[model samples]
Target: MSNMIIEQEPDDELYEHYRFEAGKGQSPLRVDKFLMNLVENATRNKIQQAAAAGNIYVNDVPVKSNYKVKANDVVRVLLSHPPFEYLLEPENIPLNVVYEDDQLLVVNKEPGMVVHPGHGNYSGTLVNALAYHFENLPLNSSERPGLVHRIDKDTSGLLVVAKTEQAMAHLTKQFADKTSEREYIALVWGNVQEDEGTVEGHIGRHIKDRMQMAVFPDGSQGKHAVTHYKVLERFGYVTLVSCKLETGRTHQIRVHMKYIGHTLFNDARYGGDAILKGTTFSKYKQFIENCFKILPRQALHAKTLGFEHPVTREFLRFDTDLPEDMQDCIEKWGIYSKSHTIEEE
Candidate 1:
């Protein structure tokens, strides 16, 4: 009996727990009984429940608890929730709520607030705040309470959270089916030539750097990601654009923009922190540095979000203004670009 246990969180919502390869000499046995013998602390009833939920798989197909495990068959267990690594602690953090009802709520999340607890960020997260504010916010498949989707910590924007299991399921399906609308405002380090364009590629973690995402143009690696961008304003060296997401992947906007030679301004992870486009003059360098100081992080914001209300089926859309830092940075660039263009003429 050869078996391997690999606990991994592939994405935000699914956890892959264990894999077993039955030996050649292995006799047929009920999968539930087999798992009870192998998986520690897993009761027969729990195994049945997981199987009923279609979390148990043999050769990548969902199987019932009574299915006989055959010799050389590959068995795997997947779960909606991860192993309880740490108890979620509710913190009394203030939230900027935009809209709320019995079924769901929309929050205008500010920059520098993490969406959930993970790694070094175990406290001071939006999840922690939600825990404190709401009672019994329904847990999604990933065991996260209320979250249907997430935006990056530094990307200020609107987020809708579900208050019930039905809301969670319906909203999750909307995002997965790409029926939910998500739009972002980004300032990138170049004058985007096209007024509007679409970027299609696969987005995955970088081969060398796990912290950053890279675009796989060949579709060989990563998840399919599409971003539609329309230029909103142009400075001499930078452009402000609105990006609509067709598929949400980690760092999709940053990676896709970088792939198209216009990295988001001050995006440290994607090499936008350095002045990628600008003159070499000391004044120009100082101006860019000041802009970086004002923004401090990637110049991207989840400015708009739209989706069908889970219970009512009414389409809901929310939009927000850019944060003060980004607004100030854009204003300075506008002034600089105008002055620079005059000098050139």
Candidate 2:
């Protein structure tokens, strides 16, 4: 049997990273054909395409689809999130293009838009918009055309898109090499005790609830993930923080913050929607609920993204302001905190 071992660093847009050790009894076969047997839901065309993109490796060296796999051979594959199950259809969704050129484009994505079609979302995504806006864009392993990285659907922020195959490969290697820079602004429940700290843990899919991810503190399971955070502002019941990712595992910021007992404000999945801190006074309760109404999703924003240009090799960086809902929510907290201090005085 060909058993698989997977490894990854935190918050990466590449969803599935796999390593396979071929059984001693395995016969030589085309690498693409071999992968077709190992990876589920993968078609021969997709596997060949991945090989063409240099996404498949044998013995740590990139290989072509025609390369033959032998007994005990080691193979690795990196596929982006949201499996490529359906043909892409372009949609005319409006995009906030921050920067664009012949090589790539930078977009300031608004909140509540899916990055790609998958699971419950199959239309009106950033990919759909990109497909409509550009023709003949390079397709990544996940079939997300031109997407180098992505933020969560409900999170607002910047993402880079490649316009050419060379750009796609160059950008993917940059992210894989950990040379790209991404920082997020988040509002989490309760005042953070430390001005700055790093959270380290192994994150994997939850055993019982496969839809959610859990951190394994002992390294018994999951991939190594790291998030470095600094306090940006503080309210009595909540705090604002900036998080810099050293690794890009799925849900790294959200899960790490929750693991440290400071979940992102209004993050429903991690229990941040509840009043984890503050007084039980009805007025206080009403205020918290109002803030929830202001920003129904998690208060996280991809505020900054930096990378080297794929073609020009010039270093580039982009920053964006907080979305209106998050801004209004923060302003409300500021006002409430000041009024409460006056009452106590």
Cα lDDT, all candidates: 0.84, 0.84
lDDT of 2 by residue, 1-345 (tens): 222212223243333356688889989999998988888888999999998976787875678999999999988775544334346789999999999999999999999998876444667889999999999899876556898877788889999999999999999999888899999999999889999999999988665554467899999988888999999988878999999998777778999999999999999877888988876678888988999999999999999999999888999999999999999999998988877852352
TM of each candidate vs. truth: 0.77, 0.75
Model 1 agreement with the true structure over 120-143: per-residue lDDT tens digits: 466798999999999999987656
Q: What would the TM-score be for candidate 1 when compared with the true structure?
A: 0.77
Please list the residue runs of candidate 2 whose C-alpha ends up more than 4 Å from where it truly belongs after superposition: 1-85, 341-345
Q: Which ten residues in a row have the lowest lDDT in candidate 1?
A: 1-10
RMSD versus native structure for model 2: 11.2
Any runs in candidate 1 off by more than 4 Å, and if so which?
Answer: 1-84, 342-345
Q: Residue 306 deviation, candidate 2, in Å?
A: 0.1
